[model samples]
Target: MAEPILTVKNLSKSYGEQQVLHDINFSLQKGEVMTMLGPSGIGKSTLLRCLNGLEDFQTGELVFEGQTVKADNANWQQLRQKIGMVFQSYDLFPNMTVLQNITLAPVKVQKKSKAEAEQAARQLLKRVQLSDYANSYPRELSGGQKQRIAIARALAMHPDLMLFDEVTASLDPEMVRSVLDLIKELSEQDNMTMIIVTHEMNFARQIADQVLFLDQGTILEQTAGKDFFTNPQTQRAKDFLASMDF
Candidate 1:
C-alpha cells in the first residue's frame, strides 16, 4: 500500500523496570487515519509519543518514509520535521503573537523567508477559522482557539504525518466539537495521514480508517473502523464498547 508511510515493528517501551508497551506492531498507509483506543493509562499516549520522538522506546523500530528509525539516530531530527504533533495542552509561546508562533519554526528551522512564512501562517490561520486572531496573544484566546493556533503552527511546518494526543481532552465540553471537527475535516477534505490517541469514542468511530484496541500495553484487536464498533472480534474490545456511555 504505497510502502506504508509509517511502520512500527515489535515496538516496546518501559519506565525504569516497569514495561508499558509490549511488542506493539502496526503500519499506517499514506493519508490513512489510525486511532489508538483504550482505557486510561493503557500506553496509548506513550506509543504516540514514541512515534514522534517525544519519548524513547527500548526495543523495536519505526520505519518512516521508507527509512528505519532508531530513537537516537541522526536521521530522527530530520524526520521529525515531517511529523507534526499536537498535544492536549495548548503549548503556544505566551510571549509570541499567534502569527509569530506559527511562523517561527518555518523561518528558523525551515529557513523560509519571514514574508513567506507569514503568508503561510496567515493562510493556516484562515483554514483554522482564526484569521482575526493572528495578531492576538495566546493569553487572549480561549482554550479551543489556542489549540487551533497550536495546530496551525504544526501545519506551517508542512508535515507529512500528524500525531494527535487527546487534543480535545483538555477542552471544555462546548469547545470539543470545533477541535474535533477541524481534525475530521483534515481527514475528509485534506486527506491527512494521522495517528490519533483519543478517548472520544464517537469521534473515534467516525474518523478512524483503522482502530487499534489496546489493553494493558498490548493490542487486543486491530480491525477496520466500521467493523470494530459494530462487531468487535475480541471480548476485551466488546467489554470496552459496552462499558462506554456512547
Candidate 2:
C-alpha cells in the first residue's frame, strides 16, 4: 500500500469550555478524495478547518507528508501554501476582477511575477470554464461562477491538498451540480487530494474514495464510500443515512 500523504491521530478541538471534536483520526493518500458526512454542527467543518490550520486544536497530531504539524512550531504560512481551502461562501474580493482574485496569492505570497501569475490564473480560469469572466467583478457572477473562481484562485497556488468546508451549501439547487462537477473533474484529471465536508450524499458517494461519518465531533465510522452507504457499521451512521433518505 502507498503511504498516506496526510494523517491525523487523536485529534480533538474545543471552543472555550465546550468541546467540538473528539479523538478524530483519518488519513488521505495522494490523489484520494475523502468526504466528511454528518449532521449540522457536528464538527465536520471544524475538522476541515483544523486540517487546514484555520483553527487550532487542543490535542492530537497532524502529519503532513512526513513532518508533524505543530500549531506553535509549524510555519503556518508555508503549510497553508501546501494546503489550500475553499469555504461555503465564495469569499472573493468584490473590488477585484476574477483574474485579479485568482492571481493575488501567487503574486504576493509565492513571489511570482505579475505576468507569470496572470498567465497561470488565465489557464486555471480556463480549466474552470471561466475564461471569459476574467475581467468580471464578483458581483457580476452567479453563485456558481463565483465559487468556480474561488476554486481557480485556490488552484493558482498549486496546493498539494485541498480542504473544502461545505463548499456547495450556499449554492442554489441548480448551481450545486456545476460546482460539484467541477470538483469531480479536478479530482480525476488533476489527481488532486481533497477532504470535503458536504451534505450532498449522492455526490459524496460518487466522488469519494473514503467516507468519514462524524457525530457530535467524534468519528462514528470510517469506511469505503460504497460500504458506508450500503452497510454502515454504526447506528449513528445508519441514522445519518436514513435521515438523508439514502
Candidate 3:
C-alpha cells in the first residue's frame, strides 16, 4: 500500500486558557481529497491554521512525507514549501501585480531565477484560467479572479499538499461557483492532495474522497464520502448535514 503523505497524531490546540481542538487524529495519502465539515466557530479553521503553522500548538505532532515535527519544536518553513494553504481573505499583496504575486515565493523562497519563475507562473495563470489577469493588480480583479490568482500563486510552488480554509467563504454567491469549480478541477485533473474546510455541502459531496466531521473540537465522524453524506455514522454528523440542508 502507498504511504500517506501527511499524518496528525493526538493534535491538540488551545488559546490561552481555552482549548479549541482535542486529540485530533487523521491521515492523508497522496492524491486524496479530504473535506472538513463542521458548524461555524468549531475548530475547523483553527486546525487548518495549525497545520500550516500560523498557530503553534502546545502538544502533538505532524508527520509529513515521513519526517516528524513536534508542535513544541516545529519549524514549518521547510514544510511550507510542500504544503500550500489558501485563506478566505485572498492574502495577496495589494501593490504587486498578479504575476509578481504568483512568482514571489518561487523566486524568493525557492530561489528560482526571475525568468524561470515567471514562466512557471504564467503557466499556472493559464491553468487557473486567469492568464489575461497576470499583469493586473489584485485590486483590479473581482473576488473570484483574485481567488483564482491565489490558487495559481499556491500552485506555482508545486506543493505536494494543499490546504484550503473556506476559500469561497468571502466571495459573492454568484462568484463562488467559479472558485469551487477550479478546486474541483484541481482534484480531478491535477490529482492534488488536499484538505478543504468548506460549507458547500454539494461541492463537498462531489469532491471529497473522505469526510472529517468535526464538532465541539473533536472529530465526530471520519468516514468515506458517500457514507458520510448519505449515512452519517453519528447523530452530530446527521444533524450537521440536516442543518446544511444536504
Candidate 4:
C-alpha cells in the first residue's frame, strides 16, 4: 500500500468537561475516501474539524499531505491551503453571487488576479454542473444548487484533501443525489483524499474505500467499506449496521 497522504495520530479533543474525541488515529491515502460513521453527537464533525485544523485539538499530530498541522504560522497556512472543508449547511455567502463566492478565497488568499480567479471559479462551477448559476445569488438558488456552489468554491482552492461534514445532511431527499454524485465523481477522478462524516450509509458503501465506525469518542471498527458493512468485526459496528438496515 502507498504511504498515507494524511496521518492522524493520538487525535484527542474535548469541549469543557466532556470529551468528544479520544485518541483517534487513522491514515488516509491519496485518492481514497474514508467515511466516519457514527450516530448524532458522537463527535464525527468535531473530528473532521480537527483534521482540517478548523478547531484546536488538545493533543494530536495531524500530518496532512506531508506537512504537520500545528499552531506554527507557516505550517498552519500551508496546511490550510491544501485542505478544504464543506459544511452541512451550504455556508455560501448569501449576498455574493455564486461566482463571487467561489472566487473570493482564491483571489484573497491565493492572491490570484480577479480574472485568474474567476476563470478557475467558472471551471469549477462547470465541474459541479452549476456553470449556468454562476451569476445567481445564493438566495436565488435552490438548496442543492447552493451546496453545489459551495463545493465549487472548495475546489477552487485546488485542495489536495477535503473534509466533508455531512455535506448533504441539510438538503431535501431529491437534492441530496446531486451533491453526492459530484463527490463520487471527484473521488474517482482526482488524486484527492476525502474524509466524510455522514449518516448516508448507502452513499458511504458506494463511494468510500474504507469506513471508520465511531462510538463514545472511540473507533469501534475500521475496515474496508464493503467488508465493514457486510461483516463488521465489532459488536458496536454490527449494531450500527443493523440500525441502518444495511
| Deviation from native of the Cα of residue 61 in model 1, angstroms | 0.6
lDDT measured at residue 39 in model 2 versus the true structure, 0 to 100: 94
Q: Point out where model 3 deviates above 4 Å.
A: 70-74
Please give the CA lDDT of all the candidate structures: 0.92, 0.91, 0.91, 0.87
Candidate 1 accuracy as lDDT: 0.92
With a 3 Å backbone cut-off (N, CA, C), the pairs that clash in candidate 4 are none
lDDT of candidate 2? 0.91
Please provide, for model 3 over 59-166, each residue's C-alpha lDDT reduced to its tens digit, 9 standing for 90 to 100: 888898998874443468878888999999998999999999999999999999999999999888888888898899999999999999999899988999999999
Query: Lowest summed-lDDT stretch of 10 residues in model 1?
Result: 70-79
State the lDDT at 228 in candidate 3. Answer: 91
How many pairs in model 4 have backbone atoms within 3 A of each other, for residues 3 or more apart or on separate chains, i.e. clashes? 0
Better of 1 and 2 by lDDT: 1
- In candidate 2, stretches whose alpha carbon ends up further than 4 angstroms from where it belongs are none
lDDT of 4 by residue, 34-134 (tens): 99998888888888887766778788898865666666667677677788899998899988899999999999999999999998888888888888988
- Superposition error at 48 for model 1 (Å): 0.3
Report the C-alpha displacement of residue 27, candidate 3, in angstroms: 0.6
Cα error, residue 238 of model 4, in Å, equals 1.4
What's every prediction's RMSD, in angstroms? Answer: 1.0, 1.1, 1.3, 1.4
Query: Candidate 4 at 108: error in angstroms?
Result: 0.6
